[model samples]
Target chain A: MDAKRLTLFAGHYGSGKTNIALNWAYRLRDEGRAVTVADLDIVNPYFRTKDAEDDLARRGIGLIVSEYANSNVDLPALPSQIYSLVDDRSTYGVLDIGGDDRGALALGRWVPSIIAEDDYDMLFVVNKARPLTRTVEDTLEVYAEVEAACGLPFTGIVNNTNLGPETTAQTVLASMEYAESVARATGLPLKMTCVDKRLINDFAGQVDSLFPLDILELYYMQKEGM
Target chain B: MGEKVLMKGNEAMAEAAILAGCRHYFGYPITPQTEVAAYMAKKMPKIGGTFLQAESEIAAINMVYGVASTGKPAMTSSSSPGISLKAEGISYLAGADLPGLIVNVQRGGPGLGGIQPSQSDYFFATRGPGHGDFHVLVFAPASVQEMADLTGKAFHLAWKYRMPAMLLADGTLGQMMEPVELPEPHDAFGTDNPWATTGTNMEREHNIVNSLYLSPEELERKNIERFERYKQVEAEECLWEEYLMDDAEICVVSYGITARISKNAIAEARKEGIKVGMIRPITLWPFPNKALAAAADKVDSFLSVELNMGQMVEDIKLAIDCKKPVDFCGRVGGMIPTPDEVLDHIRALAEGGR
Candidate 1:
């Protein structure tokens, strides 16, 4: 796993950013590192980092959630605990931000303190299967909008391409050229590529860095064994 | 055949329309369905087509009316509230007997509702979308691939019947992504429409497109003729799908995303040795009465699963003539019933518990 003191995950709503954040937090906890995840998503209601609070707690990870998280209320109350987590240098902090410019404002509130600390990586996760980010130009445009809104530069890119449960090994492999095109245009390093663990064998000796996904969303859905 | 590529349902609908010879599009941005207009804005110019972002849904529908009267293929799309605003213009198009397409990627509604998927607009789409004694064909697609195929079907049917057709999809179908094989692009709208409102040019008789009639007798005559045409459509264009319906005790009736969810529930029920099946209506306006009536003869009962509060159940009941008890399982306000919940409903009905 790529280790950083402060890492930010930002993407479009259905780009699977929450799952990537959860995976990173779980991986860090598995390695016996102090991990803290802050749910900075207030725009979308269906999927969020707070949904895995119990699993996160079982692994000895701390979670910072809004007062009105997972409800219909529009109030954004990111508590002060998030500030201390960012300040704590010994712990790894992952912020799962929401999609679009309006959602990036949640991250803007912490930009001053984040720049003051000066050791962070904001990764713009791209799903080539998504409508708006299918092309290199469209993905760059979305990246620029989020950058302008949150006042942060995306240090790297992660090609986390999938079609929900219908994802296949071919789907992830087909995005390699597209991801390369995006990396070439933006001059950002290709940080990693994420895919379901079932397809890890197909990607052997292919990608530079591979993050095997555990299908957290489907696990939650079928948890009751229905 | 175009190569298979993954696409969102909304963008696929726009690409399908372009492939079906739709050169003119007028739409306003709304949640869950805005991708359709955005895709058109990007692709239409490259293909030498017209993509206009109208000021409002009403203006977009009126623009569709204008282009349609000129015998050109045109379309517009919106969500629930925006669709409600296009009601008057839809009535005008139907009254004038013009061919066009309208797409409704429905979100929750009654007012400016939430942005999640909902199927609450069944009654509005199938019964009285516009005003008075008019029928607009409605096709419901359950997947990203169907989203493209059905939009192409809608354009063809619109021209065949010289009437407005609707692709009634919900937010889940609009936002979800899947692999699809797109159709080949059509050349142009045929130039043989005699009733088109093209300038006379002194070589042919003058053509006029109007829905107004001063005499009540003439208006009544037009309405009767349109009803006759609708009867012909009902006889021919009622499309539906039956899944594992052979030798089943209960049938689950659904369409669009809800139907996709129901298939999962049906498979679960089958594992427990309960013979459950499905009848998915591809055309909602025709309502697939013949298929439902036929299923009523073999199935013990029916459970209509929807993302709305029992809207399509009334049509099912009427179709079967209340021969078998019809029950409803639904969720409202953008809430979707899980596959386990739907399976529980099926079990209850099979056990004569509902």
Candidate 2:
């Protein structure tokens, strides 16, 4: 499991990008690498990486989110701390880009610096279970929109197809062809398939580059019986 | 029915409204519930439906009124402040006996409150949204699945009763994601609307839709007639869910997200040897009084859990006729009462501390 200096997750809204970014940051930290997560999500009012701020801090991972992330203000204000991602080359940066083209627009300011580094991996996360990105054509449409908005092309495709808390091993298995089609259509490498940690045991030898996710959003609500 | 998919409560309701034959949607965006308007804006045009982002919440609801008057399924959604702006239009829908789906994905507020989940609008919704004497059929969904299911139900019931129906959701429910099996697309717009203001072909008299009556006698008669329909609704349309109510000495009353939190509290209380249960009102307007009244006979006491400052406590007292001690446990101004907080309340009640 090799990670670039910077790994960015961008996709359509509700495509599980925030959750994947958090998981990737944790993986980087566990591998004894200095990690910092920059949440450039101004599009979504709920389910930002900042929701896991305390957990990230405890794990020795630095987090940079909107100044008004969970303040209920709904202002599209990104933190100035995001510049540290590109300026500070000593730490591994994981970015949780906002949902859709509107969300990805926040990435425009950092694109030049990130491109100068030439080592960032911007992965387009796809979830077939979402209503909007249900087809290959629709997924590609979102991919193009996100890329156009952020001025960054995706170098990899991550199959994050899920049904939230109801995701099953079979659901992941069934979405393989769809994920492969997306990867093939975009001519990008199939970087990984994200499976919920609860179901990781079910995909022992069947899948490659299987990334186990400790779904933080689901954990927050379901743990509280909400 | 469709395969299970992950959807936010706001998006699920928008999709469910479309499935229920709501071809017309008019709304102004507000936080925590903006996904509803966004989803409609994207899907409605593609489906040949009308999705208009009106100039204001007031204008959006009036657009709904216009479409609903023509006997088509129309809807509008907003958060707390936005819903307040549409109050006059909702009252007009009720007064004119027009069927329209009005979704209030509530946020904390008296005036432009913060954009966080709050059930503080219980009184605003149940008592009547506007000045006139009217009750909009209100459905509070606790889960994302119920968010989609009850949306279809709200449309069906609104048309059946010839009045406005509101899907009362809080910000937490509106934003949270869960697996939901969406309802099959259906023509919930009833075929028989003799009072609809569809242009009469001169074969029949023009159907007039109006709430204004100059004559006092005519206005009184119209009010009485609407109340008669409401009586029928109260009797046959009241919806509620009773969880572990049998043989329980302590009853917990809640709805929407608070109800989900209470269930967990009830489970913990039960494990601690407290005989506790829950009665979740699915229909807030109809109030589920009969169920609460019956629960009063079996339970020693009741606890009303809410996200507001005990707004639903008054309704619970009225429902039970003050038969037993009713305690209130709640958080206000967008604060959610955690399961442990609710459990502690239940434990105190069980110990006769409150």
Candidate 3:
């Protein structure tokens, strides 16, 4: 399947959705596609797409963020430039949403425009390692929460399971069963499976599309002096 | 003791609070401190504990007062702005002599400040949390592990002294992730206190929980009694860490997140053959005076490095009775001083003094 003209990534917090969305935006920009990565994350102050705005701008990808991003204010100020990307059909727009239902409420505002104008795909990125979505039933509950909040049906599942630095091929491969269960429960396609670039060769034929993880920045602070 | 698990400072404090037998948590959400409430919300229900997200910070601390009135371990957490709102309730809790834990994951602020980490609240926390002659036993945590450890200790100390205690952390400590070995859940200390306002059904004399004393002499006596307890806390509960102070010529004093940076600066300065050390105060209220005073007798000079504009330096000077030249190096308004910046201060202190 080709990349949808408009794509939104939504999932639970700490589900590795932001990294997946960032990797996808860079892929489109590198391929000479007109891309705009909108940071619709207002829930978490840390690990938002807005942190990488300068890097995205240099690569010719438009980055939209909250007016209060990187400042300490909790109040969100979404820019009017966001609607321009949604109205433009030529641009491959990727909305990196905040975690869970509270974050999905932000996406609800642009629902009418999203449905009326563009052929969009809202992919629910799943990571089994996160706390709330460890079990099959728990995964279904998270999907339902996001769906109910966003008022948009998820189009597919993008399995992006890992335990940060401890992740190996086994870590990525072992999540296949859990990801398949989520796809079956939601009646959605398992569109892609993400693995770090180092292990792409091992998982070529196993998944539908192997998304190589080109992680540019890791902002998670480790223990001091470790 | 359990296996060390990688966790955020906010979540670690939540776990440690639960492990400390604190079953009641009432808090309003604020930036750089919301995760503590989120973690409590997720875990408190499953464990059959009360996790009420109050309508406002004022209501949250009042809820804390209610739970603490029952002689049960209760807690409320917030950042800078929210803590300001909870000031009235905190004073009420202190005046009533209610034992509870108040976690302040401090952000930069005088009013609606930025969400980045800051130690600017040193004056607000230690000097006077609210009106009247009162002090919340403030413990400043520098690491995720201390975030967990001090939470448990704060609860125990709050109960031990029958006074309000605070775990004063900054945004960096609250948001940062590190491995922590969580303490075992202590048994609940509920309704066992002799002076608790549990209804007396002809069991004994009625116990009242309040701060009201109509007579002038009675109020003075109550104030004197509280000070006596404070004196004991100062004697027994002053906790600090002196890193490389044995042969140090320049003593760097800091606490909380700033202390972490100072420790690194001390190491860097030592690498260059500069005799630098640090005194990281785990407890901010007692001020760790004796240790700094002793160090003053030997060290050539002192440098107070903090996230605020030299608030704690005044205390450092008073602690040593102005014997040594205590210089100040710090950043304000959410800016963190780099190790190099602090190291430069250490070098300057070394060169300017004997």
- Error in Å for residue B200 of model 1: 2.8
* Order of models, best DockQ first: 2, 3, 1
- Tell me the tens digit of each residue's lDDT in model 3 across A13-60: 667777788889998888889999988887887657776777788899
In the order shown, the candidates' DockQ scores are: 0.25, 0.79, 0.29
Task: Please report the candidate that would top DockQ against the real structure.
Answer: 2
- What is the lDDT of every predicted structure here? 0.86, 0.91, 0.84
Error of 1 at B254 (Å): 1.3
Model 2 ranges off by over 4 Å: A217-219
Model 2 RMSD vs true structure: 1.4
The TM-scores of all predictions, comma-separated, are: 0.88, 0.98, 0.89
lDDT of 2 by residue, B1-354 (tens): 778888989999999999988889999988989999989987999899998999999999999999988888999999989988999999999889998999999888778778878999999999989979999999999999999999999999999999999999999899988888998888887688888888888889989988899999999999999999999999999999999998789999999999999998888898898999999999999999999999998888999999888898889999999999999999887788889999998998988943
Better of 1 and 3 by TM-score: 3
lDDT of 1 by residue, B1-354 (tens): 765666878889999899888989999988768778978987799789999999999999999999999999999999899999999999999999998899999988779877778899999999858998898999999988999998888888888888999999998788766678788887435667888888888899888788999999999999999999999999999899999999888999999988978899999999999999999999998889989999999999999999898999999999999999899998888778889899999999878832
Compose the digit string of candidate 3's lDDT tens values, residues B6-85: 56789889988998888899998988999899989877998899999999999999999998887888999999889889
Ranking by TM-score: 2, 3, 1
Model 1 chain A worst lDDT run, 10 consecutive residues: A217-226
Give Cα distance to truth, residue B256, candidate 1, Å. Answer: 1.6
